[model samples]
Target: MSEQGSSDTYEENERVLVHHQGKIYEAKVLKVEHTDTNNKRKRNTLYLIHYQGWKDKYDEWIDSSKMLKLNEKNKELQRKPLSSLKKKPNNNINQQHQQQQQQQQQHHSEESDDGRPTPTPSPSTAGTSTTTTTSTTSTSSTKRKRVDASVQESQRLDLSLPETLRKTLIDDWVFITNDKSLVALPRNPTVSDILDTFQQQHQHLEHVKQFADGIESYFNKALGVMLLYKFERPQFGEMVKLHPNKPMSEIYGAEHLLRLFVKLPDLLTLTELEDKTSVVLSKATEELIKYVEKNASTFFLKEYAPVTTYYSRLAN
Candidate 1:
């Protein structure tokens, strides 16, 4: 399928409208597959879909090209009226409100127990009552403010791959700095130029040293010192291992560290070469890929690009 077409298709678990047997029904994508034709040269994409009201036996793969994606507007149109499903509050809430009113009436009645008209509350007593009510109101308001702040803290904006990185990533040439910043370089930047850029961008920052230190720790835990050195001059068929205790800075200089950031694709490719016959990926490489995928959205939004375009560049 074309990149444009693939992007338009519903992703897994996304709701869509499916046309089947002269009827249209809401369906969800269960899986997506990109395969080759019988000749094994042409790409064909299929979506495994399950219609909302259909039997399990009826669930089947459909051509992705035929699927209709439901946008937010379409979804709103399809949603059933919530009023029909909403349940009225239980009797307990009403009972509590009634009990509070009854208690206040009883207090007023006790004030007139002698059957004579009750005297007005003295200034001091009224003042104390007002103060108590004010305190209670303030406490409730403070609790509400705390709840609002907690909710705000829990909500986080989604991240995406940046367009600048996306465009450069397709060419397999981009650098992600230790500070999680992205820089898109011209095609095929030389090692010297890449290193220079890294230094120029982060040299003055006081945190650069700390960031570099963190990178060293990451190298120690993820790619052992020996494997990391090998990454600089990777040989074919050599297995990469994690060396948790090895010190990265003592063994590998700053140049190798900078190269690691700039030549990430190359490093991943090398890992792939080493584990070609294996089913599982290297732990370090898997972690790296996951980070990229997870932050792709955040990075994309900062640079502001279509999600499809970002994904297309990633695939490249």
Candidate 2:
């Protein structure tokens, strides 16, 4: 949660409407972090949040952005999980984090998505190319950089999609793009859950564990820029609304996680790797996806939740 107003912060024991599990619940701030930082850069405030009724096991380090004062109006704010928001959303996955300050006016209605006019990249990622020199104008320099980044994205990824899983990707696409329905977010068996399960199942293979980190590292990094479709960008958007700077793979479900598989080759285009290492890594990726696909029955959402659930529409 990156955006916070001064009033948003709370003293220890302050009650808050915690946005958790796609629903808001009352919680108390048990502890606060980053209270001492005075640097000019954005200081992320982490709260040791204790859900009122949940056992201590549910306590989490929550970003301040997700904390809302416990008030009647704020109570109904649609803190819908990204895996579950209804309606249209914009594209340009990376820009999801360039969040505007929370809209003060009540947002009683669902957000509508028009086509995105441009693409944006995350600050953490550097453009792969820098050779193109442009005019002194800032806009021209920015264009030059984007062109360079696109150049590296062109490198043919070493990983190939398995035929069966490839077919699943097609189904996933039609489910979202053509069906106009989203896989309700904070998904059950989230991408994070699935990955962790896979890692646990294969812990004996240390290399597989390492590759899990490899994929997770890039999954958090590349998901915004590489993994999202225009309609699905709403998933990422809902996340930003509730938890900025948090990794998407963790909260997003198997549906969006599958997108990571499609884009990983392009996103992780490793031009500098040795040929032998590349083959081993590519083989590892194949093995990982096969495991994920094999458990589709348990992992994938069977009935896509309509964004306009009665509870959601009744919110606020």
Candidate 3:
């Protein structure tokens, strides 16, 4: 049995409760032994327990883990004054006293000529009535408080988005348009395809190659674009098939993406994409920020515009 409080060690003859076949029995520890098994180096302790009211044949050795030390009732018994312990009657003594009282009650009933035994209230029963009432009232109040606390905890919110939208946002690549509208790109797009799309759109800008090179370097160093496509395509396809006309932002907005990027290191670790050099990784991250800023417009949703601005400032 496991020791209850300050000590892990238990001594023989200690009173305890042993768990046996889903029932708890009051028992005394007869012997405590530590043995080293042949197959394992660690030593294990076993307790031989003799259950109260059980025959010696039923006594057996048990693991320490299956034992629990004396509970409140036993503790209270142990703490009683010696005078009280001396006055307390054993089970056999109580039974004999009860039989004598019953015999007297039967004799009194016979003298009354009713033959039926009249119920006589015992002094102990009368004394315990008030205690039982007070105990019940206190128990009910405690239960009410626990219920209220549980209800309050259940109602508490963590301020996170719904699970589906959160999963969709983090698992797929999101795109921003010049009009400040958000889009979730199909996961099948290769790194080369993404580069082509950006180059075609910003062909007149001289610095576009820097952004492209940054993206290419990051993909080659950290996680392959092909790997992302493989991991994300099926879920993306299902979402698109369900809502073909809905903008990706409507399905999972920029706020979700903002939260996703906030835990970028955790995401990278979870996806096993952490091999990139710090310089290349940082450059790629900056390129993504710049891409969003270049495309973002004043017409963007109020909730999303601030995220773009924050990343834009970081990039600069």
lDDT of 3 by residue, 1-316 (tens): 1122123456899988544432235778888766443325445566667877754434555555445568775344334432443465675533332333344344244322111111212122111224577878888797896786555434322122233432233222221211222334422233444455566766565456775664454343333212222223344455669877753333442333333333343234333223344444455554554444443332123322212554334322
Minimal lDDT window, size 10, model 2: 108-117
Best by lDDT: 2
lDDT of each: 0.37, 0.56, 0.42
Model 2 per-residue lDDT at 153: 50
Model 2, position 256, has a per-residue lDDT of 61
- In angstroms, the error of model 3 at 277 is 88
Q: After superposition, how far is residue 185 of candidate 2 from its true place, in Å?
A: 0.9
**lDDT (10s digit) by residue, model 1, range 54-151:** 44434545554335567654343234232311232354422332333344344334321111111122122111223577878788787896786455
Candidate 2 lDDT score at position 269: 58
TM-score of 3: 0.22
Rank by TM-score, highest first: 2, 1, 3
- The per-residue C-alpha lDDT of model 1 at residue 201 equals 55
Q: Highest TM-score: give the candidate number.
A: 2
Measured with C-alpha atoms, the lDDT of residue 150 in candidate 3 is 55
Candidate 3 pairs with clashing backbones:
1-64, 1-67
Q: Report the candidate with higher lDDT, 1 versus 2.
A: 2
For all predictions, the C-alpha RMSD in Å is: 25.4, 21.2, 29.8
Off by more than 4 A, model 1: 1-68, 71-161, 168-197, 219-237, 241-316
Model 2: which residue pairs collide? Answer: 1-244, 83-184, 83-185, 84-184, 84-185, 86-307
